[model samples]
Target: MKTIIRNVHKSFGDTKVLHDISLEIEDHEFVVLIGPSGCGKTTLLKIVAGFIPPTDGIVEMDNHVVATSSKSVPPNKRNLSMVFQNFALWPHYDVRKQLLFPLNHHRYISKEIRGSKKERIDEVLEMVGLSEYKHRYPHELSGGQKQRVALARAIAAQPGLMLMDEPLSSLDAHLKQEIRNEIKKISLNVKSSFLYVTHDQSEALSLADKIVVMNKGRIEQVGTPEEIYNFPENPFVARFVGKHNLLNGMWHDDVFVVDGVRWRKDNVSEAFKQKGMIPLRPDELKIVGRGFGNGSGAGLGDGFGGSVEGLPGVINSVYFQGNQYELNVDTKYGELKLFEPLGKWQVGDKVLVGQR
Candidate 1:
């Protein structure tokens, strides 16, 4: 059940889409391909799924060549199941028929197995919590329910590999989160190798066993969620994966100087030093009172009550993020985004920004 993609490249006329992309998905592992729009995540997925042939590369499943530059195995021939962004269920078929269609027509299922199709369908429907809606049509179900049906249908096929292309994108925010969890649970329960594609980093972080971050048709980095978020390999990945306050600066004499303001550098990699960009997450930066002395400015208690050590800045704007206040501060180098617990500071108020 291991899948390997080696030196995969794709081009459309004069435009090149994928560039030397290579990755491996282990058995039963959940791997997510995430990046901005048109970054070739979907293109690479199609290549592995046998929908298209790579210009120069080989895609192997368990040492068998499924696709290569010379030829490609057809999609239906591959023992793979795909769940699309749009619930690609038949409009005329009920949930039961939709779940049973694949089993009825699949060549892999023998006559002996065909007799248990109803039991298998029941098991999958129960896995996705759609047993009660087995008789309903696609139009009669809600967005989440339809997605669950789609998932149940895919699981019922019991393919070794599951390819999900933005399967939860069409749902609303709450439903998206709910279905995202369901997808994770289903993957764990079914133990199928999942290659999911999405632009949402949150989905990647929350769902994937390994995340492949792509940019401009090339992979930027691949690692666990903590590694991608805490120690990004490049500037693009640092900014793309999370809410980062990027400070453009030069590093010399073991110090980072930005707009004539110097700060002691820590937790920065040597590679990032060459790139001249420092990324600090939103939770890393904190807000304190304006003045140095007690009672001289807003008498904010605790950390803000005493003298704070940080770079000087003015609050430019404040945005409410439900749990915390996101403050956009105008610093000497550039604008920095930080979060605060209280919304007491107004625009144009001078403040100090420090890392936690």
Candidate 2:
């Protein structure tokens, strides 16, 4: 199911939850909606599920208007199933009963259809690795089991599209990773498009084929995980996607100046359309020989001088971060952070700074 959201807008009184959200979800593409808590990722997901009507714009799927001025469809009629974070399930029913319960009440289900439903149930239960626990009651299952049951139920519906709202957030770290793998497996079996909502950047980066980053109820940037992480569109995106050194500088005659230091803009990527603004990644910067790169070769020009080495400043802190050591150095440009290979620097080491 390819979903097209055209100029979608939704509001409650004067508070707008989604504003002019227009997106194209390609067929069978897993798209993840990611942002901070109040960024309206979930609201947009619900509207796509047909739980709420947009105040304006059209929600269309496969060339049919699901939401428009003339008509608005309800949840069940939309043929879309969802897996929620809370694992909504019936406590009174056993696992087998729970998976088959939806089919029994389905208005279109016939006796023969009900008999054939067991094949689908068996397939999904095996997919979730819960085939042996078919008769287990909901209370007997662990958190992960309960979620598996919920996933089994959604898959049994055989929806054309699946919407998951942080389904793994409630699990422990190991369980989370396990379920993430299963999500990929089940999604492949269903061959349905997925609309996933999550605040975890790693989850979005790892799971999504396309990532939609929203901020303040508006779409900020949409791209693949690599695109968003590497080639950010603006200062906001650059800061949001990863760790960045955002320094105030003026571009004068093709050179960028931060504090008293002059750096050639060529070494760093000049991304912003507006000139005189420089944003740098930590890896792009290097600590150089004190008098090497700086134009002035005076005694002061050991090279490019900064707190990392040549310049004198106290080491604020140092911590080991797995593959690298994060160094917080108080520098002339301002407080600067440098990442070096583990065991490279002790608590207090003098170093020079420059960009290559």
Candidate 3:
């Protein structure tokens, strides 16, 4: 389904939640709406799902208007299926019955699928790896298994579009990754366009063919995962999508000067330069050596007297991961974080921070 949302705006009484939102989801494309909570991501998804009408916009599916401000199509009338944040499985229904209900009674179920209901159920169950759990009730399943059932149920209808609202938010870290991979594979095998919503960056990055980043009821930017992560259009996207340290600085043409040090802004957006700030990812910085952080060579070099060519800061905190050390340092730019493989630094140690 090629869905288009144009001039979408939502409001409740005096508070406005969405502002002139517009985007497109291509057929069989996996588009993710990613933003923090209360940013209107779920609200937008509900609008597309026909749960709510937009206050002032039009929703078109394949060039036909399905929703407008005054009139809207019911969800069941649309060729789409939805998976909610919770499992939303019926307690009384076993897995097979759960999959059976949709095939027996959905408006959008194809006649071919309806005739071969049992085969369709088996195929979807195997795709989600829940073939053996067909007779199991919701109470008899693990959280991951329950989620798999939910996914299988959504896919069984064979809708042209699948809407998922944070389907992995309720799972453990390991299960989240496991189910995420399943979702990607299933999306491909089913040949259904996915309009998924999530606040998890990893899920959005790993799954989206295109990512729409929203903030304060407006779109900050729209791009692929690499474009959104490595080339944010604005400061909000930079800070929200990745672990970045926004350095307060001045831009002189291609040069960015911060705390008496100058760096080149290679391909950084003009939006950042206009705001007099630059976002440097944690990996973009390195701990060069120990220094006094006072712009003098008094206490510099490898605990010896030498000149330091980078910003000076004191280590504020240190966290040990299996492969690297996450260190927070207090520089004039503010507290910034950087990761290094060496565990030789401790809190309160003054060090020079340089760009990689």
Candidate 4:
């Protein structure tokens, strides 16, 4: 059930959308395509779903060329299912009928699965936590329930690959979090390859086994969730994938000099050094007590209690983020952003910004 996309490019009139996009989805792997709007993530998903053909390159499914520039095997023939942002369910059918349609009609459904359509529907409904809502129609279901039905229908066919295009975008924040957990569990239990598309960094980070970071019609980086979040390959990935403040610095061997303070470059990618920049995550920063000389060699500490030699900055704004406080500080170098647990910090408070 491995899918390979090779040199795929898409264009409309003279406007190019995707550029030499190449990716691979392994069996039972959850791969997420993530980028900002107009970054060609959706266009790439559409090409793989057979809704549109690539202008150049081929898509292979298990060694079989399913799509090429000249032609494409239609979506139905490709043995894959897609779930869209708008829960594309039939208005006339109840939840049970929605699941039964694919199980009885899909080409990929095996005889064993098709013969036991009633049991499969029950199993799928239970899997999506919609077992109690099987008798309800689209209008009778909430947005979350409607999406569960969509998910159930997609899986009822037992397709080898599932393509999802921002399926959780329309739901509210609380519902989004709830369904996201369900999606993760289902993706694992079903053992189906999932190629999901979304712009939300949290969803990508939480749901993906491998993340494909795309920007401006090109792939920025591809790695596991930990690798992509910690060791970004480029400036675009560093800024887009996580909450990082890019710092201008000079790398001297393994030590990085920024704002008159030298720090060791621990596990930072080489791209930062080449670009004369470093990415500092919020957790990597700390608020220090205002004392000591500006360029003293006092190393950064856990917080205001230890060493105080660091970049002098004034707190600009503070945001309460549940368990932590996100602070924006204005410094001589630039504005620095960092997070701290509930503290007595307020706007216009003078503090020294340091790295942990």
- The candidate maximizing lDDT is 3
179-255 in candidate 2: lDDT tens per residue?
A: 99898877776767889999887788888889998989999889999887766666766666655656666777667
Q: Summing lDDT over every window of 10 consecutive residues in candidate 4, give the lowest-scoring window.
A: 290-299
Q: How many clashing pairs does model 1 include?
A: 0
lDDT of 1 by residue, 81-182 (tens): 889899899999999999898797654455654889988888888888888998999999998999999888877777778999999999999999998999
User: Model 3: residues >4 Å from true position, as ranges?
Assistant: 296-308
Q: How accurate is candidate 3 locally (lDDT)?
A: 0.89
Model 4, 1-356: lDDT tens per residue?
Answer: 89999999999999999999989999999999999999999999999999999999999997899999999999988879989899999999999998888777687878889788899999999999888998999999999999999999999888989999899999999999999999999998985799999999999999999999999999999999999999999889988987788878799887778766776657888889898888888788887665333343346553546654467777889999999999998876778889998988888887777777
lDDT against the true structure, per candidate, is 0.84, 0.76, 0.89, 0.88
Residue pairs that clash (backbone atoms under 3 angstroms), model 3 = none
Better of 2 and 4 by TM-score: 4
Worst 10-residue lDDT window for candidate 1 reads 292-301
TM-score, cand. 4 vs. native = 0.95
Q: Please report, as a residue range, the 10-residue window in candidate 2 with the lowest summed lDDT.
A: 290-299
TM-score of 2: 0.81
> What's the lDDT for residue 231 in model 1?
84
